[model samples]
Target: MLTIKGKLGIEDFYRIIFKEEAILINKDVLTTVENSFNFLSQFSQNKIIYGVNTGFGPMAQYKINDSDRIQLQYNLIRSHASGTGNLIPEQYVKAAMLARLNTLSLGHSGVHISVIELMTSLINKNITPVIFEHGGVGASGDLVQLAHIALVLIGEGEVFYKGERRPTEEVFKLENLKPITITLREGLALINGTSVMTGIGLINTINTRKLLDWMICCSSAINEIVQAYDDHLSLELNQSKKHKGQQQIAKSMRHHLKDSTLTRKREHHLYNGNNEVTIFEEKVQEYYSLRCVPQILGPVLDTLNNVEKILIEEVNSANDNPIVDVEKEHVYHGGNFHGDYVSLEMDKLKLIVTKMSMLAERQLNYLLNPNLNNILPPFVNLGTLGLNFGMQGVQFTATSTTAENQMLSNPMYVHSIPNNNDNQDIVSMGTNAANITKKVIENTFEVLAIETITIVQAIEYLKVQDKISSKTKKMYDDIRNLVPPISDKDVPMYPYVNKVKNFILNFEEEIYACKELN
Candidate 1:
């Protein structure tokens, strides 16, 4: 369990999404916020502020008085509720809420304690507000989509409560809650930031990192079963290249396949004690998928590290305009809300998903080809070739998924057009990028699951009873428990696919933990 007052940071976000309970420390956050509000009072004469005392974006030039400021912010939310796309998932919306709370804890947005209290109520009560996946230009903040969140906060929009879509006002009333009154900057504070995009990208990055590690392990298992030449993954070769990703991947593959009896030794040991010995040599110096994996995957890891750093800064810093610095007794209007940083990160994440899908597609091709597979029918079957369709449809799925990923990888960062009539001309499109990346990640998982099925079926067909590494054998058996051998056509595979996903997601953790115990 974790709690956030003013001390919330990146590690807390990670654990919370990983299913840890999170609590709020409002008292501590209020202390800093009180000082910020006092500073605003002292500098009251210099109160010409954007997003605080005036209309936003193109209308920033219009001066709004104290009496009308609250209405202005309220109207801003209602008008910007123009999000017209698929509604974001509940978990993602919850994550965005958490991120917004984190940014507010910095106490620079001039939001009152009541707003924080309402946010805490929603968190503790499991009131997930509805937010859509489009209409954020990532400039002037994630305004349109987050407006829906703001509307719900004021008990005016829609929400998914207890797994049912209900009016926000009804849910609040049922929970004995009051709609928060819009304050001077509270509404703007609620919606004016990069939280929506950054939160999605951060979660995507974390999950993708785990998947990358699992891919290395799974690929090594395949290498051992196929008797790939260890020369390609040799430490000497990786050291000569000196890329961290390459070295790490090579080291990991070697470690995973270290004790396999199926692998070939040095050149001199090729001959047996008896007569002529059979030798297995791969046709290519390396399959494009296998050889370039490190190069393609390394940049993705490096880019993710950069994105994590940026997200840490975004989450911990104030992003709203007209920030008050009570310690310095000053207020400054700035463009902290621009989301170019998060946009590029999301673009990179989509690229990583694209690579994963491509790798899986290639592996699927390898397992299906008679020449490449060496053993088994045209596509790893039990009986004669034409009689059984085998894993034919699974290969079709892999190809289609890879194609989808490629299309989604078109960088959203570079597609900025003027929004709000040149005021937000150079938008980051960060929110769209994050949403697309999430879709790509889902598609990549489907591709990887199919590849796992294909490879396990191919290995079973070869019937190599010789002992593989302990880890590899365990994985094979795990897959076998869910998926029976491919003996005939027209077999129902949906259940097997679901079972494979369940196994693969948890497989690495179980294997590594068991090895550590030993």
Candidate 2:
């Protein structure tokens, strides 16, 4: 079990989200939370505190009475729990809950300690709040999606407990859990932040790391299949470009093709030959997709590194309104609830991942076209050319899915629509950005899986698997284990394609041996 203290780091997220480790809150954090609540209890006694003594958003013109103060929080939570569309998957919800818990642990949100305790229990029990994919403008920071979380905190709404959607009350009762009482500002504090988007973005970034490694492997494998010159990935060539991502990508490619017998050295193949033929058969340079893996995926790596940094800062921040300061003994109101940070990062991430998918599609095309790769049969079909279909049908799936990723890469950050009586004008559509990014990411995985299968088929037709690098051979063996080389005949391909997708999704290994994420 992992213990969350004052701050949360990226490693903490890896432990809880990926390693399936349960978490505990430090006692000092609970003390800090109680102190903040006490300070707010006295500080807001006569002053007008937003979302506490006054109505929320455009309704702040009206003041709430003392008798209705506690009920006000419940009203906000229940009313805003109006999110619609498909339910977000359980893993993302858990990450969001972790994000919210980490922020509240900072003690600036003025939430009661019961709030922290209840969230800890929910997370440890693997009981996730049922959140939807829509109804958030991200101006007030995932208002609708987080309200579902607030609703569950008060023992209302629904939760996915033990692999099923059940009433929050039923799960709480089964687990002997007690709901948090509305003390001061738990409702507004819980819902008013970028936790939802941060959570989803965190999960996306983690999976993106996996996708990138696999894409790099596929890129290196394709170069080996075509017997491309190794100078394109030479240390002298890529390092001179002055990009860390480029140098690192070239480094990884060198490792992958280290034992490859197919990739030829330009000095050995071209320089040694003194033939005076005007038009030699071998092409000088490969297509950009195979040769420029470093130049293309370099920006992808740099962007991913930046995205991870910004998200870590976001999760550890005090992102709620009316931040209560026990040390200053004051309540300060501001717009820390805005989600522009998460929104912008998600958009950038979506755009880069789409670019990766496009690269994969182009590489897959080069493998299928007989003219581009004179090494393999057309479509790598070992059967009668026209009578039996080979990988031709499956290539369509890769092409269409890549087109969808391109379409989905349009930025959601610049497409905000004002709501909340224009009080939330100039909003951030962060949740939508994150959701759409998730779709693009999953689609890219499918596209890469198709590309991976095609690369293996080319290797099989060449019958030079014995000469391939150890890395490429492992990939070939893993894929061939799922389904044999699609030669002599083609079986039903949809299930086979999905099987590869699932393999990509579930497969975990350390491919970034030369470089580790910072």
Instruction: Report lDDT per candidate.
Output: 0.76, 0.89
lDDT of 1: 0.76
- lDDT per residue for candidate 2 within 60-122, as digits (tens), equals 999999999899999999999999999999999999999999999999998989999999988
Q: What is the lDDT of residue 18 in candidate 1?
A: 55
lDDT of 1 at 3: 61
Candidate 2's TM-score reads 0.98
C-alpha lDDT of residue 503 in model 2: 91
What TM-score number comes out for model 1? 0.92
Model 1 regions more than 4 Å off: 5-10, 268-284, 502-518
Candidate 1, run of 10 with poorest lDDT? 509-518
lDDT of 1 by residue, 244-352 (tens): 7666667767777777877665453443452453654444344766656556666666666677787777877787777878777777888888999888888888887
Q: Point out the worst 10-residue segment of candidate 2 by lDDT.
A: 509-518
